[model samples]
Target: MRIGFVGGGKVATAFGRYLHAHGLAVSNYYDRHEDKLSHACRLTGAHPCQSAAEVAKMSDMVLITTRDDQIEGVCRDLADHGVIRKDHLVGHMSGAHPSLILHDAARQGAAIFSLHPLQAFAEEEKALADLPGTYFSIEGTDPRLASVEEIMAKTGNRFFRLLPEHKRLYHLSACIFSNYLVTLMACGLEALSHSGIHPEDGFPAMMPLIQGTIDNIARLGPPKSLTGPIARGDVTTIEAHLTAMADPSLASLRQFYAFMGLKTLDLAIEDVLQDPLKANALKKVLEMG
Candidate 1:
């Protein structure tokens, strides 16, 4: 396929480089920032186009790697410019927005798809290396599904299809798994800092435990993998933690802990590790403050 990119950000550069590395034809690219456009084209060996219309004219497939808010605008521009051809395949790489954001292009007779990589891309080089073995969530017309599949296959990745209505929930799950996990770790580091443990020291000390917990989850799955004071129904230990977080300055953290403890209690009961009485006792203690 003759592919083109409309934005020269990390994702655009990463996808372009990966396709080029795999011997696919990445023909042209366009970006508002001249430096970024030049860098992306250099990385992918693609010709630089001065406008989105030029990019559309040079390629059979156009991947819009712009920010989520800008995707529809770019699509509208392509349609208004008469850039999108009936035979063109157009897609955006956003987990939050569904394929419908490309409605302008679709209205102009282009096939529309949403192609989201279920991995974080902090840097282009890392993204290029990590694209393989990644899972993608794709939503599109049936006729263009095979085209998206072929692109994913070339990168050694797998994909599953989702309905447009499910995209928000699907992206929420991804946020909980990837984004919120980082926030959770930040919370842990902050709590440790109160005891004079620097983040540098805390992170190293916590990694093994974190990795072990992840391994347990992988091996046994959620409730079965849960192991902690709450899971053990240790009301006394739970009370101690609550007391430590009771400072007025830590009101939010205290509530956070309590809410999570209540959820953990549910897991304990679901896993058959605690009877109703024990679970109720744990819940009562978590709710105490």
Candidate 2:
């Protein structure tokens, strides 16, 4: 199917480039930013459309990869242009929004879908390289499911259907897994800075351990992969950590440690190899902190 892109941002460029590379037709692209639209068209070998209406007119399907807040406005604009119709399929790439955001286009008789790739797109080139193994969360009418599947297949990706009501929770989980991990890493680097290790030096040093932990998680899963003071049921070590974090400068970290310690203690209790009594003692220490 011929595809057009509404917003020529990183995600639009990534998807368009991948689709083009995989032999899909990317017919046109449009964005408020002329440079980005021109770049995306160049990257995808698509015609540069002057307006969203032109994009809709030229393609069988349109991908609205605008920022989340702009999605509804873009859809409304497309509807106002009188371009969306029964023969067209439209979708957006916002993880936080469901297909319902495209109600304006649907009302105009287009099949609307939310097709979110469950991967971070920090940069266009990296995103294009990383797109193949990505998993997409799809939600929409059954009539358009096959088109979505075909796109996923051509991109060498997998997808699962989501209920409209579940979209927010799914996006929340994604935020925790992806965005919060970066926050957590920043917290780790900050803690290291307290020990006189600069962030640049500390980050690279911590990567191996971080990678190993991720590898363990991939191999064995959460509770089974956990290994640390709490996992070992070392109440004294946990108590020491809490005490160290109690300084005014580290107060927030103290709470963070305590919360994570409590969770770790739960995992330790579930571990067949851990002593439940020691795990309970760790929990008591965390609670006391």
Candidate 3:
């Protein structure tokens, strides 16, 4: 398939290069910025197009890799130029915007979809290297999304489909998994700092435990992987945590602990332990505090 990208930013450049590496036909990239267009072309080895329509006209599948807000505009440009052919695939890489946003492209007989790679695009080279290991979420308005699936299969990446209505749920889950994980890490670092451990030093110190937990989750799944005082139904240890977090300075972290503890308590109850009586007791402690 001849695939073109409508934006020349880091995502487009990285994805274009990754496709080219996988022996796919990568066509032109068009952006309003000449330097960005040139940079993308130089990295991806795709020729630069003069307009979004030009890119669409030359490709069977056009990926609109612009900022989330600019995607609809780019699709409208292609539609206005009458460039998209029947059965052509038009998709965006935005996790936040559903495929429904590309209404203009769909009106022009294109199969509109969002093909979100669930990974952050930080460094272009690293992004390209990480593509094969990433999972993708696809949501589309049309039934002709087999082409999208086929492309993902060709890349040997696992992918799943989401209903357009459920797209926001999927995006929010990703935000929690990736973005909120960082916020949670900061919370941990701050709590450690109260014990006189400098945050910079404490963060690195916690890496092994954090990484080990991640590896455990990956291998044994969340339920079986879980271990801690909550899993053991050690109410006294949790009470000590409550005591430590009672300080005015640690009020937010205290709340954070309770919220997270409640969730973890549920996991513990459902796991092999399956001790709801203990879970109920832990729940009471968290709520009462």
**Cα lDDT tens digits for candidate 3, 14-73:** 888888887888878998999989998887778799888888888999999888888888
lDDT preference between candidates 2 and 3, better one: 3
Encode model 2's per-residue lDDT on 99-160: one tens digit a residue: 89989998988888899999989898998888888899988865766888888877778898
Candidate 1 residue pairs that clash: none
In model 3, the runs with Cα more than 4 Å from the true position are 141-143, 272-277
Poorest 10 consecutive residues by lDDT, candidate 2:
267-276
Estimated TM-score for each candidate: 0.96, 0.95, 0.93
All-Cα superposition RMSD per candidate = 1.3, 1.5, 1.8
Flag clash pairs in model 2: none
Model 1 regions more than 4 Å off? none
lDDT of each: 0.88, 0.87, 0.88
